[model samples]
Target: MKKYLPLLLVVALVLTIPGLNLDQVSAESVDDLNKQIKDLEKEQLELKEKQDGLESEKSETEKKIQENLNKQGTVKGEIESIDQQLDTTRANIQAKENEIAETNKEIDSLNNKIKELKEQIEELKEEIKKLQEKIEKREELLKDRLRTIQKNGGQMRYIEVLLGSSSFADFISRTAAVNIMMDQDKAIMETLKEDRITVETKKTEVEDNKTEVEDKKVEVEDKKVALESQKQELVALQGQLNNQMAEKETLMAELEHEHEELHEIELTLAEEQEVIRAEAEAKKKAIAMAERKKTELAQLNKKEPAANSGNPNGIFTHPAKARISSHFGMRYHPIFHENRLHAGVDFATSTGTPLLAPADGVVSKVGVVGGFGNAIFISHYINGQSYTTVSAHLSSMSVSPGQEVSEGQVIGATGNTGNSTGPHLHFEVHIGGYGNPVNPLPYLK
Candidate 1:
């Protein structure tokens, strides 16, 4: 009997050690899960910050691109105006050239007229010289004739012979003829004066023509100088226009390049933002699923307290006096239209339905929660087994966290709050705030 007792004690000790080992392993697993959750949360926060920065950059890039586009538009308008001005300047230059050409043609014609006038002046001078020579020779001949007449008149004293005989009648006729010759000499002198007057008038006409030619040459030279100056001005204006056009082209090119770059950047930012948004959405969904799973696990662990505790026979009361509208497990949701696990039981109840504590417990949490509205959580012990229960979708909570309450005490009121199709109570049970959900029906009945 003593030998058997030692063997039994050894077996019992071995069994206890395995249980202890299992407990330690469970604790380690929980710690690891907690670490993973914290790490994921930190990653989510960092991702959010990155997304924000990306969004800000995207907005700034878009603003820059818009500004560049506006500047480009303004530059294009200026370029158009410059083109118009250039065209106008070109037309004016052409017109000026035409004017200059016409002026040159007129100057050429005037030059020809001046050349003809010079020729006429030279011809008039030759004619004046020839007339002067002829006058000089005639004067010489008249002088010789006058001297012969004077000498012959002195012999006229022989007229005394004419008075002595009939021959004297012939001598008297000769004296009368000599008197006519003297009158002829006086008429010749008057004709010579008239000829000299005519030559002087021809000389005066030649001088006037020469003066007119000189005036014409001076006018043509002035016109040429004015046309040359106009051409120079036109050239300068053309150069200025060319420079302006070149500058405008460069500016336009720069703006276009900047705009294109900005557009590319904007596109990149947009794509990045899309990626960030997708990631954020995925993260949010994952987090929500994890939270739901955590709650479900806690509920399961609560119901299956025998798995961790020796006491297997324990019971808990219903959290509220309500009829079950929806059961746990997979069901098609009317709104979501997909197969989903109803993590908690849904109870159909009137608004302001009183929710009682299912067991003697201390309130662990009381606050408004997303998708649950006002909620209350209670921590309790049954046969040395710790458990937690939650009442969600409540209109109000009457107890504060850490407040003790007896079983059957009203802790909250049920209502249609947060993601509810109707007034109802969403109830859950948990053990150690972790582990899978267990069937609550076994405990309620």
Candidate 2:
């Protein structure tokens, strides 16, 4: 023992060196894990704050959307009311047009009657002219008779002439002559009186006809004017109703556009919330993993070095028993209709098909994750390197966050949820952590 004193000192010195001591290295690794946990916690807090803000924004957007719907209802009602008014106005206009048409017909009839009356008056005037010529002839005959009587006997009477008659035959003959002359005069006067009465009657009839026609025409004209005025009023009312309807329709369109925009904003905010939530969940998983590793380091004799420098093919296994439907790369998105990164591999399968874990991992997130729908995220450690696997668009989840799962363990059932086109599993491999998506085809067994 005395001869091995130097060797004992060398052994003690080797143990005392910090690089060779297992506990020291383990302590340093634990410190690093603690720092990682603290940093993850800080990031989680920030994510939580961001999630709260996104939620508030989403709530406000939903409120606005509801308000827009209410306003749209009101605008639609107003439009309906305007439509009713337009219908009524159109009916009224049609009725007014009918009235005007009837009035025009009446006026036309009255005008025709007035024309007939004018013709009748002209005929009466012709009769009056013939009667005037007859009266003139009678007057001339009477004047000639008076002139003859004055020339034959200036002061002699018929009675005195008869008394001076020489014989009875002469007296009889004179009486006969006087009787004949008187008869001729009486016939002439009778004819003159009848013509005057006839002329006066014709003049009165013509005047009466003219007065009746004029009255009827005036009344019909008044009715026509009134109808035309009413029609104009109705037309003006219809125009106003149409304008109101147009305004209401425009308002409805604007409201609908605004509603669509609000809905889009709500979706965007919801997506943001899901992103923040996923980030927070990722941070929590990191903390848990670091804590678990720190505890394991305290008990283990030595820590294993990272193998393969984070190579994927040696770490992961096939996640689902299905054929590959799509590979991770830039492709035209079926839903969004744009060229974008696929970000994952799609496994074609039927709905409710079990989704297996790609490796031994802890479930980091289990819920709706934006477009992923009922998705699950697993935090994996492969040969001391961090990795993450995502199982998205799930119909159901069997594992919850923070639950440990082994390789080939069922974590969920695949379905067509979120942005998927059909029932399939959208599986992603992130070599470092979340948000770093890589082609999972090369990594799968």
Candidate 3:
């Protein structure tokens, strides 16, 4: 009977030990899972902070770019105005140059005409001198012929000799000789008269030539006066043209300078845009990584029992070292000039402060949001229930979407961002795609 009692006690002890060991294993696994979830939540909070920071930086860059564009537009308008002025000035200068050329041609023609008139006048003077010499020679010849006739007794003796001739043939011959002498005297007189008349005619022609030369000289003087006037006018016009050319040159130079400045500004803008694009791409990649991690955590949570999944009382740790500057609630916006609902809490902190995760979780979204600036969202599990936490208005981010993060891990810092009055972090708790915005104070310990 004693042997049978010992065997029964041994069997009972073996069954009890196995049951207790199974219970202990279950409890240990639940605790370990909870710890991991808290760590991941904290990591997610840190990533949210980093995303907020990036968004703030992007906003500032956009503002600066807009201002630069406005300035460039104004410069372009000024350049266009200058270009028009330059064109007008150039046209005026060209017209002036043509006028000057025409004036010079007119002066040259006038000078040539004056030279021809002078030559004509000189030829007329030489003709008048020749006529005067001929007249004087003819007058001397006439005086000599009259003196010979008087010395021959006026020729009455020759006529009587011819009339008293004894022979008829001698009388006839004497008569013929007398007649020839008379005819010769007549021819000499006629020649003298003709020479006198020629002299008178030549004198008259010389007077007419003198009168014409005087008129020509007067005309030449008038032409010279006119040319001088034209030359003076041309000089004045040339001066105006020179001034216009100088003005045009100045305008062109200014336009060129403006063009260069615009080009430089465009290059700067392009570089800035490239930098912004790279930063945005990096942020997007980070968000994707965070989402992947959230999906993995969700799968893990699904496999666990509800009681062993996560914190059931909604207790979460603070994500970073930051002071709350504004509480989540309805608030007045300065720019909008209206009361609006503030979806998150604002935390004031120094630039580049380290941000930490609030609980164990996975990063879900990380990127820029318009009003929130740079922002990040983390998905966390609490007793089989999933919740998302958002952080905004940060200067930079350090984590990516789908990345696993533990509690209190560094992810980003706090900063002032879009629609912000000061440096602070905006934090919020969301469930089911922002449909429910819960109080962060209730969830965070």
Model 2 quality (TM-score): 0.51
User: Could you say which candidate leads in lDDT?
Assistant: 2
Ten contiguous residues with the weakest lDDT in model 2: 300-309
**On residues 1-445, what C-alpha lDDT tens digit does candidate 3 reach at each position?**
8655434433332333322343344555445444444444454465455446555655655665565556556656665665666566566656656665665565566556556655654664565466556546655766676676676666766767687888999999888987887787687678767766765675676567656656665665666566566656656665665666566556555555444444434443443333333333333333323333555445544442333223444445566566667787888744235796767666677767777776566666566655566766665555444456777777888887766566567888877765467777788876432325776766765
By TM-score, the better pick of 1 and 3 is 1
List candidate 2 stretches off by more than 4 Å: 1-44, 150-184, 278-445
Considering only N, C-alpha and C atoms within 3 Å, which residue pairs clash in candidate 2? none
lDDT of 1 by residue, 58-93 (tens): 789888888888988998998898888888878878
lDDT of 2: 0.73
lDDT of 2 at 124: 79
What's the distance in Å from true for residue 340, model 3? Answer: 42
* lDDT value, residue 54 of candidate 1: 76
- On TM-score, the candidate that comes out on top is 2
